[model samples]
Target: MDHAHIITELGHANITRRMLATHYAVDSEDEQLVRHIRRLLNRGDLENWKQRVHALWVTERSGVLNDAILGDVVHDEAMEVRTHAMHLLAERKDWNKTQQNWVLLALHDDHPNVQRAAANALSLHPNENHIRPLIQVRETTPDNDPQWLYGMRLALRNQLRDEDSWHSLMGYDFSEIDAERIADVAMAIPSESAGDFLVWMASKHEVKEDSLLQFFRHAARYASREQLNNLAHLVPRKFPNKSELQLELFQSVRQGLLERGEGMSPSILNWGSQMVRQIMQKNITSGETWSYHTIDGVKNTPNPWFLQVRSSADGDRDSTFICSLPAGGESYTGILRSPIFKCPEQMSFHLAGHDGYPDNPRQKKNGLRLVDSISGQVLQEAYAPRNDTAQPYTWNLLEFTGRNVFLEIIDADEGAAYAWLALGRLKPEVIPFPELSPNEEGKRLVSAAQLAGELRLNQYIPNLKEWIVGPVPDASVSIAAAKALSRLDEANLPARLSDLLQHSGKLGTAITALRKAMIAETHTTQRALLSEMVGMLPLRYQQEVMNLLSNHATSTGWLVTQIKEGRLSPLTLRNQVAYSKMESVVSGDVKILLKEWKDSLPAPNHLLQDLIERRSEGFDFQNANLTNGRALFELACSQCHQIAGEGALIGPQLDGVASRGVARLIEDILAPSRNMDPAFQVYLITMADGEVISGMPRREQGNAFVLADASGQELTVNLSNIRTRNLVSQSLMPDNFDELFDDQQFTDLVGFLLHDSSH
Candidate 1:
């Protein structure tokens, strides 16, 4: 028999009361039918069958899924039941789009678990639809809770066609294509120039470690090896045997051979041996040094462990290198490992002074001077040059045993810093760092791929127009600014979306410029887009964007109303949520609806009330007093009442107290004997296992016995999860306002809880 049949068999009696009276006995007559009864209970519509539904809801909420008939729950009119049903639905991904939208809507749900349930569902398939919302969620979210951000990033990757990179790197299965089809996919790699990447992969024991080697090695034949090599130059290679490839030797020889047309350079063979000798000699004789300026700014100490280089009165700069020996080792033979370059006089180079101190130190006083390697020009008094918060000093330790150019802090007084001193093999190229330039109008515009995509329309502005007119140029723009402009356009949208087509130019730049112009020109769709774009700006600008949108409150209000009336699309709702302007939109009955819906459905009522109240009162969650309620719960109420399976069952479980409303639960707690569970009426020998032994009082047999425990595992348990059992005078809830719950706290506490268990 299914749940319906079993419930009918149990009769209309309150099963909870009956179960309690029987000391949760396993009825032998129904024992054979228990499995069938369970099956039936598991399949019935829980919400309609109040007692069964409440039990299952509680059971599911408590993570007692085995006893909880989860499959039978359905999305229904009862907010609590539907919310719980939605949570259970998380296990089923085949839920239709309507179901999916319901889940998404639950993202704004009032119930925390309902919202969490929605989040869990979205997390399973974090793709385009979910990612944007998740991004909006990241700011207010705790840094430790990586769920929202991670889910959003995952979803964005899916939506942005980044499946290959993510799946490949994270070991996720993104595609179902077979090996032949895989080859077809391989052929579509955009950067065939990274053929060296494929070869590197082919050569790798890890990548092609198993049978996968066949695919990569075969694919390598089709790669452009030359282009791949050039690309590989940029790719970091730290393999153990990489040096054995004689890559440096091969490179030099290949260059010379190609330059001279087949005649190999003799220098190539000797180069490796000479380099090895130099490295070995350096390692044998050279020592490392550490230098730091003391915090007082009075003294510069090259610790005893480091070799000190004092500045000489002579024109030549004094340099120091120091080495400290470990406990077992007597001497430190590590090389100074200075770059092979023409050494300068009067230059104070950094030395490794101490093991823990700064490898590069900063000058306390101003007027520090160091020479620029690229220009050989004297630069004075630079700010702290290194990100070494841990060790602020001179002489950074290299990760591997390789020589590279480094910046050395010159004068402790003169903050000036100089880098590009080649300590070993690393050479500082003269290549300039790329910078974006302004147009003829002196208006800065970025013309990169990202810019092109973000601003696909509008070519009127000279700067933006020029960007569009040119063959695609790769220039950087402020990603922040581009994002800001996008939000702005979204906020001040024009009446006609087609008007956006008029501003067509190079993609991102033109679109941005056009949107800006439109926002300035009229209250057009482009203006709306720009407004919306503001919300997407960095956190630093969130308040600023909010202020800007607030300036046009009337317009925003009208737009929202129009959208709600179906005169406009719900695109505005999308924009509002994206911009996190839901607070401004929620007011009056609309506010009431948003609040009620959120409270009843997926969003937690506490969170909803918190947000609404915070927005209304102008405070953040941290500053809010919601924690007061939790504090109260921990202190007094917990003594008698159990919630979420934690507290004493000498009282009723308070976990579902949240669902029952604060006042009722409070009243019940205040007067326990008034509405005592009829089944709990019998007295029993207190068992060791928290089970209450109770039965009808019999004159002949003396006091009869019955046992009731939290778990349905009814037995004359000599041992229980709870230690001591007693008859208490007070109600299980502990209604005293002083020690247990303060008046405001009680109000807030009641507001926070409203749970029903699906047994």
Candidate 2:
């Protein structure tokens, strides 16, 4: 194991494992060996010397190497050798001030990778004196250089005790910094001024959309109620047409207010009203009404109900008529008369009631009713059984066909009762309305059913069931309804799902519906029946069914058993399907089976290298067919990426990906994590309940973060329940396109990505 023998062995075409072990054992403690390795590293004849240096660094004992030698290697011609030397120096715990200065110097390295390694080393053993130099480096670095962003993050984290650092970081012009980094700094800094600066930037500065979104996301997690409310005021005015930004602002502000137990400001309330109006496609001004009148039995001082601003469903508060009747007032009545117009397709409003004086027991008898303006017939009535808490209600006036109507608030109780009414609007059309044509209605119903499932609104179970079993059943609508019903009441879902499978005209849609229902079904007998039914389908259809069911724990176990027992073909678990199965099952015999299947595939980089070489030699880009490329992309790539708004948005959108050049595109396809962005890094979060989730961070809401997983499903995990979160270094994008497609097919895909062609 002499140094000469080690150097010769390292230069071998493929060094044997025993030689590596021997080199690791002797190189660190042997001073003579270290000296010899250093001499070889300085020589020009030692080919693959960088590898030798890497092996030497890995084998060298911490604090054993001389400072002068380590410092010299820190400036080596090879970046990898420099990085390895810096890494070795950083491992020493006994580094004095002079040696620590070397780490600081490495932070300003010309190469981004070297700079990142130095930054990581600095984070391991940070010193207060290093903060100023790091800040200086960040200030001088060019914005376009990727290293600049890394420098900025390092500076922000190591800000130390300097109050001025916050201002200096925040004052960087938009060109010098991005919104995401600014927000990250604000979140890390425990100062009110930092949060205020973000709000001010959002309101006064012309921030780009992506950066502004990051700011809003961080604000939701860290900003105060008043600060978020202030930001909300600027949103409607500043980004009137940006629905995503508006939604984020509104949700953040509303959550902030709700958490603080406060009400929304007037400006936020107005913005919410406008959002509702826009969603309903109604003219904002057309719904305005001021004909509220009280009946003759009220006291002279004030009517029982009057127009006021109060908390409503549309945010923390909305403009609505408030009704408050005092005890022993005999009886009081309030009415809001509508302006005459043609009968609307839908009329809806929010209603909330509470005891004005909770101390009095006599306020429990109050009731509110909606009545026809001319006939005085009660359309809907809500009674307050308990007067201590606010009871909210929604009134969908689909049955009310008249042009004019009245909202009647009555109080006959001996104690005071109060109610807030808002979001009252009459729209000409609403989604999933009964009057829509069959296809449009079906699509709308599918969307509504999905929303209901997300919210876990069990009350919608009956409605969803009706959609599934209705006389004119649309396969899409029935499938969506079945899925929603399965979520709401899993125990009672198999029958309805079975009915759809037997009667539906579209076999694929029906099987999908049945598959979803089976995934959620807990009864073993029902699951067995469902599995048997799926087993009878074609192998392709069965594989698709397995893909949908693989995410469920119990269903995955069943499928694995089926595969093992020869009830299902092993070919079903191949390629992307195998990857999906491996990702879903965390632990068990199923995990072992899926992992074995995964390990049997060809090495990813080997396949990638072969493809790259083939393309480099002679791949015809001029004659590549865009249509075929699109077809291949939709089959292999669309599951994660979006192309012309037609695919799942689990990965980055490829709208202008062609402009990024074919070489860059090929590199990405071959080695996705080679230079992966931090934002796109997937997080592996283990919950306190033992459930493991992996996805990219979508947004922060209150104490939870929403993550969108590989299948485009969003999972919201509470911060408190997270046992551990590890940032995965690799990209979520799976590799091995060479195995998935032939040379011509892969070329066509590259052509599709490099041109502006649509399906």
Candidate 3:
């Protein structure tokens, strides 16, 4: 109704406040009324009242308030009030002592919002006097804090043009500063001294690697031609193993020097350009090219033990040396010789073994050997058991000087075995050699064990078993090796898992292996063994193990008991029960207990449906915590939908979503499948192998189409492999969010989505 009446009702309703502010802007010229409004704005207790005051100030261009009153408002307890006060101060043609002091005070404010406002205000009046205070504040503040970062940038921007400012900036200990921010400021400053300081920082060995990399990148963009040449020379020594960094640095240097009509040294140029080309091509150096040969008078048969050059069986197109032996072939021999080179301290080659035939107890034996061609002595040997998958093996030839070595594949058994070998000299810096460090040997062994599992070579089972039970102190390696062993041979897995469980130190690993086995094991006998083993575990492990086993009919009663006892979380129980395919085992007391538990929890479906039907008609927006809602949105929705450029671009951005109205937003969240954008529709691509993958189509790149899955993982499927593409009627966004979160959580989430602009 009347302006005074609306002003009186500001505390009662948000709409009243808006109407009052609008009326004050257009019609009110009364000084008493302006003072009254200013007093109301100064009252920081009212939520967002300062924003309404700011709206009135903007609409009512005439300044009814003096400097003192505005200065007092700048110190208001609310951040928005202080921010708006700073904005008003920035509009002043010349700030007085009081306003400058207030601006400086706001700069040191703990809130990033006030600090950003202060920074913007200071930018309007860029004075050298502000630099010292900014630097002091930055030095005392934590490096990770955004305030310190913004303060540093603001300080640098104000003083960057002055050559002497570089000295002041460089004098401070930058170790406490974020390297990325330092680089950003350095890049912004156009002074040559700033460039020199960055180059100096880059050259320092004591600098952190992250800082060094950042400094190097910026220096490349800003440094002089002489500095670039110097940096080019140091690149090979400083970052020899970092091919990516080398490529970046080289490109930067080449571009920078070319613009200045200067060039780097021939050797540096050649090395850098060659490395860039090599990295772009993804090429690996196969040392001293090896040639394959069969033993003389061994009767080279095409059916078994024949040497052939072929593409790597692992899908890598690199040429590999393959030695094949057919089933029922016995006593076959072959040798692969490397050209003589000044042999290093050690040389290694990748070897993978696969049995062409399936698992059979009657299959014959197969073995591979490495020998020195000069001495005709076996350096290393391996033998595979029957029914083994392709297994990867590694061979290291040690202490061979100027002598060629031979790789021998011998399939002496009646079963077929194939060996794939690829020789490449590994840089010790890039690839860890087990012999180099005892501490790292465990990690290397773990990698080797995993590779063996990937190749499905059952031949390494005994070695892996020894590693698991051996004196190797690293439990992680032991666990990994045990997992590899389980993958190779499932028959003895229960016994191995039981042995692993005996070591309390490896309980975590044992539990992991046990869980995997339980999920994969289909045999009733194996499941029984798993049950027995799980029973033997300690009580603490039993809860989690039983949770995994909850899908089994035998374990449902145990799960219900745990749930009733408060030992199991409701969320975990709900997830397990919902997804479980176990035959109905709940009866009598157990069924009653489950029903009681369900009744005690908030029913998601009913709550969601009611909220959707009611819309915002009966919703209590004032009580909802927007902060908690933002957290929930980040946890659940941020992966796909972005709001204000803060999340992934997999889905539509929710910026200005308030314009869509609460009802529409609710409907969108509750029923995402309705009236969905055709572009956001999920596509189910069936591969030639019958595997189905569903995701929102991102783009078509070359022969592969990229798609973003619900989990935010991007998948690149080859067009050739896709047998059919079907557009799904449903949205990629999961529909169970309503079921997943409680009513308060759902309200908070929607509140956050509505206030997207505020965030």
List the candidate 2 regions with Cα displacement exceeding 4 Å.
1-434, 437-480, 489-522, 533-552, 567-618, 628-667, 670-679, 688-690, 711-715, 734-745, 756-759
Candidate 2 C-alpha lDDT tens digits along 1-759:
566666666556564753574456464567676556656544434457445564446445522455565666777777877777667765766578877777788877888767777776765665656555665566565678766466557555655324565555444555334443445566566455566667777776677876676566556444665776687677777987765457556665555544334455666666665553453342112433223333332321123443334454445444433344323322343443334343343454444454345455534335556566567677777665343223345556666765465444454432223432222222332312123222333344455555455446665565565555442213455566667766666454253343334333336554554544444425666566665666566555455555555544655666677777666666566435334544655577657767786566566557667667667556568968887887677667877888787678778888888776677777788677777877788887767755556678888755657887655657676777888877876666754454556778878888888775323
Clashing residue pairs, candidate 2? none
**What C-alpha lDDT do the candidate models reach, one value each?**
0.35, 0.57, 0.55
What residue pairs are clashing in model 3? 359-387, 364-414, 365-413, 389-456, 390-455, 391-457
Listed in order, each prediction's TM-score against the native is 0.22, 0.37, 0.37
State each model's C-alpha RMSD to the native. Answer: 35.6, 23.7, 25.0
Q: Write the per-residue lDDT of candidate 1 for residues 19-106, one digit (tens) a residue.
A: 4422222333344444444444466633344445444433443444451344334434345555556656566556665566666666
Give the winner by TM-score: 2
For lDDT, the strongest prediction is 2
Report the C-alpha displacement of residue 137, candidate 3, in angstroms. Answer: 2.9
Clashes within 3 Å, all models in order = 111, 0, 6
Better model by lDDT: candidate 1 vs candidate 3? 3
